[model samples]
Target: MQFTQIEYFLMVARLEHMSKAALELEISQSSLSKTIARLEDDIGVPLFDRKGKSIHLNEYGRIFYKKAKKALDDLQEAKTEIQELANIQEDSIAINVMNSKLLPKLFFDFYKKRPNVKIRQYVLPDKLAQQKLIFGDIDLMIVINPIVDQRIEWVPLFTEEIFLVVPKNHPLATKESVSLIEAKDEMFIVSETGQNFRATENHLFEKAGFTPKIAFEGEDLSIILQLVNEGKGISFIFQHSFLDTYLDNVKILKISNPVCFQTVGIAWNKNRKSSFVVNSFRDFAISFLKDSANKDFSN
Candidate 1:
């Protein structure tokens, strides 16, 4: 019933553990448990199912969780609106990217144009980033192949192709392009399983009708590229990698058969109110991507 009680309940519901939630909220576990018990008593229903020391939000709890989160978000939006009216709103945006390694130049470039705007960037997987986008916790997301949702606005920013890479003087290094079938026997350096980059490569490999002979799998892209650079194996690389990466030791070849390309996009909550600064940056991003998309990174 109370504002603080609702805040506590929402946190407990999200974490699904009293101790973890208390630690996050900087309060004692006993106090958080008592607060949840009082909240359930006031609501006239048990919100969580307890087993041993663990807990799970029940059906009623899920319903309340959604409604309570929205109510809080709406209250925050109202406060922001008031600040905007007085011309005192903060100029900032929070963004989460799946492949954030390719974005330093973009952020630095934007900073040069809008030095007064504050930016917070996070590197997260596509699905988790989408969840935070829906929750209004993040203002925008830069994702590859975003999910279709009614409450989210998705705009295609650019398409970046995947190219085969090899150390100089390798057999296939002289070729301008190669088919996946032709390279099926080549020992490849690839991303580790369960990685987003790996998932993208996996899909392209599946569509190309052959599994690669992987010589090494790494979670760190720098290490994988290093392996390719050492003549240990060949690998695929995104075109955007050429923007900042030093590829003088490696030869980047186009993938002719599959023409594997990833469409990157900007995603945001359609219902969340936006500030003038956010809108300005969105426009700047679209223009930036447009210009970059036209450049050829194949050299």
Candidate 2:
């Protein structure tokens, strides 16, 4: 009946465990249990099918859960609308990106033009970024190999080829191009499985009909490059990821067999209403990237 009770019930329903939900909600287990019991009593039906310590949502609970979630989402949207109206002059936008290196220059360029607008950036894995977009936690996302979703509006930014990187002194370093199968037995370093680059690596290896011997799995691109510099293992990297600093110790080769490439873009939730600042940034970013890509092509 109460908003707090509904919130607690939703959390319990999501986690399906009293102790875990209580810990997450930062409330005592007894209080959480009493709250849910009261909610069930008021509704005149048991929401959960309880068996010992585990609980699962029954038919009634499933129907109510969807309604309660939507109610909370509506309340959150209302709060965002009021906040935007209150601060119409100075606006803030939240964005998530797969790569941190590309953001500094882009954010700086935007900040120089729109000094009053506040920009918040987050670097997250692909799965987490998509989740935040779905929940309306972030206004926009800049990503590569974005999963296709009906709820999202994707604007293409640019595409770049993925390269195979190895230490300059490695056996295959002198080759103009290398097939993925040739390197099947070689030690490889790759990003964590959820990342876009990692997915591309897996696809390339799969197409070449061999599994790579993964020596290290890391999240940071800089560290991955450093590992290659030390002759620890080779890795797949994006074309833009190759900096002059890495040129001395590393050699980047094209993948001849499959010729893989990834398209990076900006994605926004179609259902979430964007604030004025968020709308402005979305337009500006799309235009800016399009222009940049055009100039690169012309040159």
Model 1: lDDT of residue 233: 90
lDDT of 2 by residue, 1-299 (tens): 99999999999999999999999999999999999999999999999999999999999999999999999999988886666545545688989876434556667887776676788888777778889999998989988776689999887888777878999999899998998788989999998887767887888888889988999997777788788888899988775553536556888898898877778789999998887669878888888776765565466
- lDDT of residue 156 for candidate 2: 80
- Which candidate gets the maximum TM-score versus the true structure? 2
Q: Clashing residue pairs in candidate 2, if any?
A: none
**Alpha-carbon TM-score of each model against the true structure:** 0.60, 0.65
Q: Model 1, 176-285: lDDT tens per residue? A: 98887888888989877856578888888898899888888886677788877778998888766632265568888888988799878888898987776677678787
Candidate 2 least-lDDT 10 residues? 239-248
| Candidate maximizing lDDT | 2
Clashing pairs in 1: none
- Off-target runs (Cα >4 Å) in candidate 2 are 1-88, 100-102, 242-248, 297-299
Compared with the true structure, all predictions reach lDDT values of: 0.81, 0.84
